[model samples]
Target: MQSKIDPDMVDLNERHELLYTSSPIAALPIEILSLVFHEVQRTRRATGKPMIPHVEITLSHVCSHWRAVALSLPSMWCVFQHSYAPWYGPVRPTRERLAVYLERSGDHPFDLWIDFKTNEPAYQRLFFPLLEITLPHVHRFRVLHLLSNANHPLKEFVEQLASASAPLLETCAICPDYSHTSLTSLIANKADIFRSGVPSLKYLRMDETSMFGFLPPLDSVVHLRIETRRTVPSWIPNTAFDAILSLPNLETLSLSIELFELQAFPSRGSVPKEPIRANKLKHFRSAYVLINIYTLSHVVAPSLESITMNGVDLAGLDDRPSIPNHVAFPSLRIVAFIRAKGGSHGARHGPNLQKLMAGTQNVEELLFWGKTGIEENTEKTHCMLLGTDSAPSPWKKIKKATLNIPFSSPTEILLYHQFIAAKPNLEVLRVPPRCLELPTFLQGVPPHIDLRAIDESEPPLPLCWVPGPDWLDTEEDPFLFYCRVFE
Candidate 1:
């Protein structure tokens, strides 16, 4: 065994050992290296970018020890995203790469996303084969996202998912090509795809029309978001509303209604004797484009603590409908009203707005956007809320208030100043940056109040209220001011 060793070979081995030992990254433990690899994958996902095979490929190439560790960890290679980019040419070669991932992932659950950018027959021919190879592994799919055209072979994929026993499936989002108009019909016909047997499925989001035909039990679903398209009217038939109400465990509900075309409402005789109640619902938000206020009167949640209404028209209807005076939201605490343009008129000044505010008397936080011409008469409009008279005011308990609206006339500015000066226990008041620039805006504020300006940064922090350093110039204690933001 001690034959004359080649001096050249000994020199090469020594050089390799020196390089490995000198590298600082090589000193890290295998667990740390694995975490670094996971972080690379997470960064890609957070940016909504397709997963690249180079991460694991490059890590394994670093050294023999690294290669062995990367190969042994299945979780690091479990997420696969295939984005169809026309500029990348043909994606047929990626199938082989996908196979490598499937082999390396071993028994770990997988998260998969396929984004289809084109519907050409040639491209479909190249893409379907990869899907066929991935179909058998559906049982391991934990999160799946499907984006495709109407004519794509999604029907076959849905059929496979229906029959496949996917016990680990948790979240699934199916979106059609944005330009396609047949989404409702396409989803309606596939009613049986996720009808039963998926026990772990929870979070669900879909367009409003997609739920018109059929839906899964969705008993375990905690959050539900219904997005209404501009092309369709935001009308949920009684049966559909009943179906949504059946989800006993639903905690948060969001309805994004773009527009509401007038439809014949049920006659007084046909109105339900008892309003539907959502006992577990804690938060509710609705964004409307000319909706009938009476339509919302049918839904009543006793446990709701927060309510937000955007662009809702309570006074636009020619035949003003009334919300039953008896209906009360006992647990409601926070309320926000973002009035749409042309939404405020002479008719809304008194009964309409007052009635809505009177229902939520216990609200401790109120956000009001009063930019319309009708709101210029702020003194008379908000007089009911200032607790100036003997009548009980719902806004008396409001501790935090945000006013992100225009003040065109001096009278309007003066009226708003009076409004803020009236709240006795108010601790925080937030206004637009422009409002702070007004000559008399700060002078009207009480010395005890913490006045803050809204920072208009990109991706605006609508919920955050922080006292700026500029507040120090006003003789307010810097330590007493605090900043708070909401999710």
Candidate 2:
């Protein structure tokens, strides 16, 4: 049987087919479309304004089919970070929007980031329901506690969260909290973490004080990061240090401590009676502490590959601590000591460079920083010269090194010229930043220096960031700004 079709209905069907096949948005995969939405939302947050000019949401209002697809796919509406601006309007509506987003995420594991910049405690209470709904699904959580007031609502949320059983929890990051007077106070207020069994937690980071108290016994955490403040805590307990060492699977440990507060717990028997050792541990970075060489010799696992000390004060060995000779690191490869101009008891490591290299024979990369006041005196500066009568360095295997020189005057340039000329095997040479402007520095240099062949190629010099506490304040790329000239 043949029936006559309406002309308007046939025309509408043809147009819908053309639109679906021709437009780029219709061609996009669901994942790619979700990423596009994420990028749009990210830009809105950075600019600190209310402007959702995307007209896609209005498309679902046209019919039930589009709304059903959008609602069924949880990823389409799971992100809500618009609560930063309080002046925009009431907080209840945003809270409701967040609850909707959480509900849409469903039972699938997901990464959750919550930044509580809003200073109002009353508005924070509104998020409790959202947290209750979303906590179970969080696999990775990053909470930035930027609230200025003493009474932080997020703190209460964390307390409640720690007590609740979260089977899917894996990673957590807690920034510098201004509310707690000390680490003990922070832990005492949040001791409920001890009761919480995060059997699946793998990575944990906290400021030094909270690290002592809140970290429960974890057998699976592979990476641990501890950041301490500039002012030393009154003291840290030995039991706390013991608890840290006891972690069975801790592989990479990064410790960021100020120069004045690098001492090990008790300065005696910090390691537990059980002889706790991390068989898998490899990398260690002490951001600003004058590293206790003895501690390096004893505490590190046998398979250590890289050790970096940045802006630490390495002074007279009289006060330097000792480690048991029984301990040994057989696989050490890269060792870096980055000292800047303002370091206390400056340039002491220069005198012991040979000893350091000899200890790590397999070293591939050795970095040293000598800029301004570090080498102002010729007697003190002579320590860097390889075969000088007073200073000798036998760091033969080093393939790459960096020297930071920050000077605008000619006298410093002439001094640095003399300083760099002394090392014959110096494959990598970093001219001071100020001197790079001069044509003579880069006159005939090739675009890229080839290290393997020593011909006309200049040594493959590269700029590196001197790791210190201040590095945290800037972008995550530690060496990007200093290496812009190379670009």
Find the candidate with the highest lDDT and give its number: 1
What is the lDDT, from 0 to 100, of the residue 432 in candidate 2? 44
Give one digit per residue, the lDDT tens place, for model 1 in 78-128.
876666665434677778877878889988998776666566757766666
lDDT (10s digit) by residue, model 2, range 268-339:
433444544556777666654344442453364677776665422244335544434344566776665544
Alpha-carbon deviation at 470 in model 1, angstroms:
34
Give the Cα lDDT of each candidate. 0.57, 0.47
Provide the lDDT at 176 for model 1: 40
Superposed Cα RMSD, model 1: 8.5
lDDT, model 1, position 302 = 79
Q: lDDT of model 1 at residue 109?
A: 94
Cα lDDT for residue 462, model 2? Answer: 24
User: In terms of TM-score, which candidate is strongest?
Assistant: 1
